[model samples]
Target: MEQHTVVLYGKPGCGPCVAVKAALERAGIEYVYVDVTTSPEGLEHVRELGYQHTPVIETSDDHWTDFRPDKLAALAKGLGS
Candidate 1:
């Protein structure tokens, strides 16, 4: 498994983040969406990965800043290996 779980760290008014979410939805991916603007835990989680913005896509083994496609794939697939 490339990821144990998919966590999408997002904030309000982020267009790219929104696109990322939409892509995930369109791909039929299951993920946990967290609004960092409202959740300190969410911010702290991604902070460990050095991301200081919204929409930090994360898995057990990967962190996607700015919504990368590979990250999305890993998120959709998960840590099954």
Candidate 2:
């Protein structure tokens, strides 16, 4: 995979957020974890993206909310190119 950035916005005690983090780690995908509850910028970013949920994954080409294994799989596949 070429150079890329993936940001995961989440808060503590969020189940889906934990799942998303695990999935990404298992896929060997590097990501930045931003605690929305602690970071004002992270909170604003998610709000700007129109998401009212945790585990909001943001990449250069795409962004989505919740623990989407399908989307995560797609992202892993795309990284091969």
The per-model lDDT (C-alpha) reads: 0.78, 0.91
List the candidate 1 regions with Cα displacement exceeding 4 Å: 1-3, 74-81
Model 1: per-residue Cα lDDT over 1-81, one tens digit each? 254667789989998899899988877877789998898888888798798887787766767789687766665656332
Per-residue lDDT for 1-81 in model 2, tens only? 125788999999999999999999999888999999999999999999999989899988889998898999998888862
Off by over 4 Å in 2: 1-3
Show pairs that collide, candidate 2: none
TM-score of each: 0.79, 0.93
Give candidate 1's error at residue 6 in angstroms: 0.5
